[model samples]
Target: MDLTRFFADVDAQPWADLHHAYGSAADIPGHLRALAGESEEAASEAISELYGSILHQGSVYGATAHAVPYLARLAAAGHRTEDLLVLLGGIAEGGADEGDSDEAACRTAVAGQLPLILARIDAEDPGLRRAAAWAAAMTGAAGQVLPALRMRGKTETDPRVRAELLGAMAHLDPPGTAAEATGAIGAHEPGEVRIVALLACVDGGLPWGAAHHAAMLSLLPANDLVQDRLDLERNEPLQYVVEELLRRDTDADRAAAYTLLDAALRSAVPEARAEAVWAAETACLLSRSAPERLAGAVEALAADPADVSSAYSLLAKLGGRAAAAVPVLARLAGGEGDPADRALEALVAVAPDRAAPLLARDLERRPRALAAACGSLGGGTSGTPFPYDAVLLDAIRARLRGGGPGGNETIRLALLLGAWGSRASAALPELRSALPGAPRAVPKALVAICPPEHRETTAEFLTAAARTGPADGRLPAAAAVRELTGDTGPLLAAVADRLTPGGPAVQEAARLAAELGPEAVGLVPALRSALSGSVGERTSPQLDADAEIAAALWRITGDPEEAVPVLAGVLAEAEPTWMRWTLGRAARAAALIGEAARPLVPALEGLLDGRVQVPPVVLALHAIAPEHLDGPRAAALLLEAAERDDDAATALEALVALGPPALTPDHRRRLTDLAERDLRVRASGLEPGIAPADERLREQAREAARGLT
Candidate 1:
């Protein structure tokens, strides 16, 4: 275990010039040395430090590549072998920071130690063998690791090690793995081995036949037995399989995922059925048929008290698409407690019209349903709110008058009344009564629920709040006043006063200033002062503040002199995936400047390489300099992004912005396929209003395709 020879040149390696996530790598060698020390506690602390710095959050750096050689040597010498190997595996697999050269260096460093790693694949210790196999695959030296994994797969006795080896083999040699996957997935293999082999068939692009489906059914609930030593991070095997199958997004693939889950749902075993219900939720997001085809089976499972929570969750995620399940959800919603609350929540999301009457009956008792009802209003068109039901409106009014609901429930009540607009004018007295106790929650609702006759009084109250309210309450109050009265005079001073604090408050103030247009020219100095802060590489409030200020400046003054440079700077400095929100704002601001922002075209085009940037960049280019875009290239990128659930809505919006001429015959055909496809595009992101977003994307795709016609 002597590391004297390995340490000979470690200190001389010019660590001062390199950097990791936290900056200087000079301390990296100290941690490396501590990792080889005898104190297990010291080694653990040292490894944690290294993970934080070098391979921080699955991102490799220059220092990471340099440290790899030492780590491989440590593992070779049996110093914390299992831990070091996993570290090496992480480094090998991590995506390097944008524009960093460490990705290749890190992988090559790991591959250079393949002999040491491969030697441990046959170790007497199962844990070491598993680690060795994972590190080998991540090396991505397929020519070297693939043959070794294939050889080890023949004799690996430890079931977990065998599973790990099979996964490694699949990673290193998909075609070769596909050729052998069927035999490994046979009845004779252990369940874990079969699971990995089945996944390989899916991963290797093998035609998933009847055998694969049967194999997966038998493997349901196998997730509890999986140790996941390979660090695959797939907690649910069935869900992983379903997601992968639907991820291909082909008509055939979606059908395959649907059929598999549909059959699993029929399993008599509650555990297997539960697993299928979970996987079906993902399927619902990726495939349109999933909700209709699987909802009945899920509803049947929900009859079991034990499974109702999970079933209700799935139905809720389906949103309006799970309309077929509303009757069952309604029956459950008629009951009481957590299950009923959950069911009513699902019912509210699935069919608000049906949920309204049910919610009115149990409004005070069903907090979850009331919250869901309130949240649904924020999803789409603010003006075209959910159709107000007199029953629900009366119940909300009664609850507010009773004064029992407080905190989030009170907020929810206010939001529900606000959504009904002038129709909820009767609740104004209740809202006004509740306003003093809950100042922040009630103002926006008051603005929305206030009628024209009462608006002047509401505006006066809000204007007073803007001038003299709590620091956190001023901007929103002022914005509401402007929205109702169309007066920027009072709001202008509030915007200037709030701009100096510099967070979300600043961002909101800048947006409010922009809404004032030429009337906001008085606040341009404050907006410029807000932009005077330092910029960071990633998205931050300051970055968003800069983007908002720049856009506001141009809108207010119609001068690109101050705004254009800040927009260009934001576009240039913001990192793609990490700073996407800021990048998008910068691009949209550039769109506002139009051809005067022409100098930013290249940066905006570079931003196109990121999925989050594509939508805004496309729209920006079309607005700034559409001729700079290569129509086919933009079409190809937009189409690829459209296939992803998270990006589809925005991507299609960009695709439509490209106009019909950008679409070739093939692009048009794909657009038609997407518009007509059962698989949804907008169902994957973390947004609360997924159903509305998905439908919007669906319609956008159809409109884009129809435009071509």
Candidate 2:
């Protein structure tokens, strides 16, 4: 707990020689000092910066292990350690550094020297005890961690801490957890303790029926359970056990789960019904049989307006097959609030073809629902391309005609037509009529949506727009024109003109050439000239321009060795943080360059050892050396990257290409589950947060999963 003592015993300055996320650990001491500093604001900032730097995106750097002991001391002294406890658990669970045994080393450090903190589990501060429980479990010293958690489990009075202790016990020793959870069930502990026991019983592979059902029923709500009991005879424990049953890997368990969930949906007690709603929603994610297992509950579940949202949410999770629920969802879609919005969203997903006509009805009746319905029909979220009939198209056409002169609405309509692509070319005349004083977005949408026959005209219009519109619109317009016509005539010349000494469009021109890839072969010399002049500059635009030109040349010339030096030179340049993404892109371009890239492997490996993006780097390594793909470093990097949302599909594609050595038994199982599980809510993959997905990403995940084994 003594900050000065902790800093003195450790050669803290040596940490600066090690690596953290944004390169060397030179800046670490300032942040560490700020953690215990007098100012509240500084300490808070220190906490955030530490999370981003030391444990960036859940990755542990060389500095992470070195700094763990100090963080442990800070947690012991009560310097806001909640997020820190989670981070420590994550590090212990998975080794963040692929090249080093940091997980084992950090586990050893905590197990050998952090006994005093384990004793803090008995501290008067419940928060400290909670932190201790998690830290102990993650320490990987099962011999020490289990005994302490078992002891704490008996005397831990705070139900929340008790739950944490129970969870820790379950993770540390699943077999031993059976005996402990059995005792807790019989002892009639608090709701949280019972819930934890119930979860452990299921996790430990213990029998999960009537014997443990009492614990779930014992949960006492902050409000009256008596009024709820009078309304319906229900078991709270059963409702929770059913949710866990979704994760169970057996059909019989799932059947029992569905039957119970369906019964709970009809229960008169709102609390019982609400919990059932939560369980049913979770059940849809259990496996590919989720929709079949949950099909029986949809009607009754949707009958209650309050419960309709949960039903339709599960249906949405069930994907396009749950077409039976569309009628009810269509009805609920007319209402207001989150439920209504979700109902419409789910309706669109489950039956986009069926929902299209109904959405047209909603479009005319509810202007509030119009935007969401438009999105569902053929807008941003229209996943799997369902055609809208003349009815809906006519309605939208009329609505477009009614818009004031030209607002953002006109752009939205153009985007909707773009979503429909050539199928909605009938509406192009309407869009063309509005283009007189419309924004540049209309032209972009027109380029994206119009048929190939109109490409010449679209190209000519966008080219004219580029000449006269705002400077900001020039690059996009030039890019669009290139896409439309593929005619290098003026584009190559225009881009080349910008490469002159002090031309304002030089960088923009360089970016356009890069976007055109190999087609802009004519602009390679200009890009090369731009690269030659821009090297070694510390400025950001120079860094970006350099990377862009390098990428452009490798793409145009089809040679990796020729591009490696320039790309590597950009990486070797001073002030790398600003150009890190550009550097990664350059490396990827070099990877595509083939055998000439062999010399760059040593440098690419250095990028992997640090906190730089590893997908492109690992991808480069995969393309270069098939032999190194099986190492602990390569396997760890690929597996981690293969599961991330942003990089998973692309990373998995590259990982699969590295061949079966990268596909371990565990990786195979994980991939199989992801493949077999229908993650699509309709045709699109379930996007994180509120963002909707395009159809291509949905197929990407599926294809990666299918290719795994």
Candidate 3:
């Protein structure tokens, strides 16, 4: 064989020709094999050419697949093994495919090359040595090569080569590999090597000496080792390992180790006092336990102020479980206990309902504490009625009936009503009466207590207040009413009637009406009319009117067929991005309107294809016509959008929606090739100029390619 000419020819030919040459069965075994037996320089040149060709053509070839085997034959035939070994290493690490060859052939080729590859791992050329270690690892020949590599790695002068050797050893796990791994634990090696060795030992289920265990423990900063140790020590019947770990581990490690201790506590082992405290405090945060078990800890903490903070912290974390501590919390709220105020605040914070009655009863006796409790409960009432609702309502009604709307009592009564939610509906007349000359607190309570059925009345009041009352109070009243009624018919009607052209109040009402759902259905036609009016003619008030009307209509009908065309029109006309996005959402909402929506698929596909006047509406189109669009067209659009990096998320979403059949092998190959190049360029801190959408498209392509294989 003319090695120099062969090398020249291999390099001179384009990648396509080389791929074609290697793909041909007849040219691979005999012709390529002859090149492997040439001089070291020639062999090296040939391997480099093969690597470049494989990468450029983006196809694995049969001849390139046999390169390793040819190298092995050269070694056996008494050629200088160093160059052959280096060439074999390059082939292994080159990411070349064996043209979808069988696994048995791959293993045979790898096995044949292993001895020469291992022998030259100590070659004077550091690059060749590192390449050998990598190739040995890539060929999956770790078992045969790991022991020799480990021994050499212990004293290998080059840090980079030593690291590769250790990494290679990490891949192999034949019988007794764990024993070797255990022996390497205390060896003077890189942290990476030590970590790998520890994992190997853990995987092998090898018992550790105290010294080895301590060395493994010292490597706790490596998360893998810490987790492995936790898994191992958790099953042991003794608590010492876990307890010691809790004391010595960092906060993260302690948190993990505590989880195991919690399991141990759950089992039948006799408990230690310190372990119990740690379990009670730490374990409480990780998971739930029986109320009885937690109560024991709570009572212990409550008995001593020294433990009060921990007790309170645990109670807050327990959330609803601390309901049983209501009585103690109530006592704390009372002025009698040592840290009574703090305890009371903590109790109010934890289980407000359970402490409400006590706080209300204490209000007359300890007005300051009562004030604090009322302030605590005044923020917003829970939707569920508390047990104190009837009592609180009765007290407020009695105060009203007594004809004394005087001072702090009035504020207290108002706070009580606000905290009672809808149950305070019974106090509506008193609330209505208190609206006059009553403190701002009274109307705040009225807003909170107002029923969904009275949403119209509330809207009217809010409108009047917005027109004449304090700005702060008016907005809150409107907000509260909007939240309470959702889309009640009367509320929608009030918003529509008061909706003036271009007013902030009208716009606010429109926003509220939209949030109300099917209850606002009556406003749809009005909204459509407003949207149809000229742009300059549409006031903020008119837009508000239109928005509220549209919201009401959608809420009432829940039928997209009745709404999508209007929304699509709005999407075509809306200038603001937020409004455009909302119109898009409305389109989405229409698609969700049940089987009646099947007829809208064509319209959606049209919008998606930019056949209509609206902005690119792929998401809405995808939502409605996922299974209906032309797959190839949709895929092409996705690829094009991805290439531009425009709305990558939406593009990828559309590609995924297009699904498997649309992702042909050619599409996948292009995407994978693009991604590999992009990743390399990005890693080097050079901009690949690939759009975000293309990145996702590449990922989808890679996944699709993998599924084919």
For each candidate, C-alpha RMSD in Å?
4.1, 8.2, 19.4
Model 2 C-alpha lDDT per residue in residues 431-510, reported as the tens digit of each score: 65566545445666677667888778777877775666555555556667777777655567567766764455666777
- What is the TM-score (0 to 1) of candidate 3? 0.37
* Model 1 lDDT per residue over 1-709, tens place: 5568667779789998999999999998888889888888999999999889998988888888888888888888888899899999998986432343788788877888899899998889999999999998988888888878878877878888988888888877877888777788888988988988888898898777788988988888767647565655665788888888887867777768878887887787888888888887777666666666676565566556556556777877666666656667788888888778888887877788988898899888888787777773343421124569998888888888897877777777888788788899999888876765556667888998899999898888888888987677787788888889887767888898988845558888899899889988889878887774565543467777888899999999998988988987787777776778778888888888998888888888877788767877888898999889998899888898787653576677778778877888899888888878766766644434554567777788888888766
Number of the candidate with higher TM-score, 1 or 3: 1
**Which whole-number lDDT from 0 to 100 does residue 100 have in model 3?**
43
Instruction: Report clashes for each candidate as comma-separated counts.
Output: 1, 2, 11
Query: Which candidate would rank higher by lDDT, 1 or 3?
Result: 1
Q: How are the candidates ranked when ordered by lDDT, highest leading?
A: 1, 2, 3
Name the top lDDT candidate: 1
Candidate 3 residue-wise lDDT, 186-227, digit = tens: 757655456556555544544434554555445443433223
Give the 10-residue window scoring lowest on summed lDDT in candidate 2: 225-234
Candidate 3 at 404: error in angstroms? 18
